[model samples]
Target: MQTVVQAAAWAQTLGLPRLEAQVLLLHALGRAPHDRAWLLAHSDDALDTAVQATFATNTQRRLNTEPVAYITGQKEFFGLTLHVDHRVLDPRADTETLVEWALSCLADTPSPEVVDLGTGSGAIALALKHSRPDAQVCAVDASADALSVASANAKRLALPVDFHHGSWLAPLNGCTFDAIVSNPPYVASDDAHLAALKHEPLSALASGVDGLDDIRTIVRQAAQHLKPNGWLLLEHGYDQSHAVQTLLGNQGFVNVQSRPDLAGILRCTGGQWPTVK
Candidate 1:
């Protein structure tokens, strides 16, 4: 009979990081993943046979290249605990930077309208709604399955974001927003890093040959959807900052700029649509 401490340590041997092991173990015990301190305090507590079996299954899933967030079915982003699964790309801490930038753009505007394209799991839209309750938030996705997951998240979180199911900007035809933001598919189709992320949905991970295909589509269409002087922000590949900056400039966006993520990598770029003369 293995105790909580022993089971967690053994899980680490399965090639999981220490924190992943602890969080999964805590989840199996019906404890919160962030309650690692509780696990330490109850170190000697013996896991029941059923609990051990569940943890073993979760360990095997992790070893099979499944993401820890998917195994646990929850990811914390922007201080919001979001429900995530295989239907959408998992949210990352890096995305919080885009959300912060969007919030800053809306700071002076009362009840600004914001739209998140390719919302995936509704991480960005929900975060913005949670932060600025006065903002009218909307999220759009191409996959109906992904939209289902995002809608469920909104319902559970009580953050009322209008969910639309269609390609980027398609569902919101003729609708203009005060700001538009997205963390679109920016990974190149042939990127080697994709091998490590084989478990995520391919459509949510890869774009076209140069990984800027979707970004190009967004830049072209965003001009019509963004109100004059409205800001458009996008999270993109770390190395594609220059390409993205040029794309925005070519699209007639003024004040074009790129922002570095938490690690100082230029990860998000944005610009403003001009006031129509």
Candidate 2:
């Protein structure tokens, strides 16, 4: 029988990061992902044969560059534990910046109306609703499959975000919001990094040749949907902030600015729709 410690070491030998190996091992053992301390206490405990088989399969999946969240079926985003799978893009920590910025905009506006475009996994929308319970949050997704994942997460978290299925702001045609936020597909279709992201839905990753296709659509449509003085915030690629800010400017948005991600890379940009134009 392989011991718990031995199994983790074996995973490391196969090139998984130490943290990933430990996380996958704990998952296979049916323990919480954060139960690393338990592993140390039970290092010598024999891993059941069934657990070992599960670990091996998940380890190979990780080796293929599949996101750990997909293998485990859950991801922690903005303090909410969301269920995820191949149907939706895994939520990343950087997206919290978008949520934070959105919250900041709505801080003084009681019961502000907000909408999230391309809300894969409902991470941004859910985070906003969870943080500002008085806010009316609506989320839109182009993919029915992505909506399935996002809505499921909302149900589980008991967050009552109005979910709509359609491209961008189309479903919210007659509605206007105090804020509209999106982390749309901004990866260039031919970017070299796309080769490493084969496991995620391509529609949720790549935009046009320049990666600004979705951002442009949002900036153009957002003007109609946002109330005067409303905010439009977006999370884009590491280097797309300037271009995104320009799009907002051309669309007559004001106060355009960018915010950095955890790594200090400018990852999010936003502007307020003019109160007068």
TM-score of each: 0.98, 0.99
Off by over 4 Å in 2: none
Badly placed stretches (over 4 Å) of model 1 are: none
Query: What is candidate 1's lDDT per residue for 122-220, written digit by digit as tens?
Result: 999999999999999999999998999999999999999999988898899999999999999999989999888868999998999899999999999
Total clashes in model 1, counting residue pairs 3 or more apart in sequence or in different chains: 0
Deviation in angstroms for 213 in model 1? Answer: 0.4
- Give the TM-score (vs. native) of candidate 2: 0.99
lDDT tens per residue, model 2, 1-277: 9999999999999999999999999999999999999999999999989999999999999999999999999999998899999989999999999999999998999999999999999999999999999999999999999999899999989999999999999999889999999999999999999988868999999999999999999999999998999999999999899999899999999999999999999999999999888
The models' CA-based lDDT, in order, is 0.93, 0.94
lDDT of 1 at 152: 93
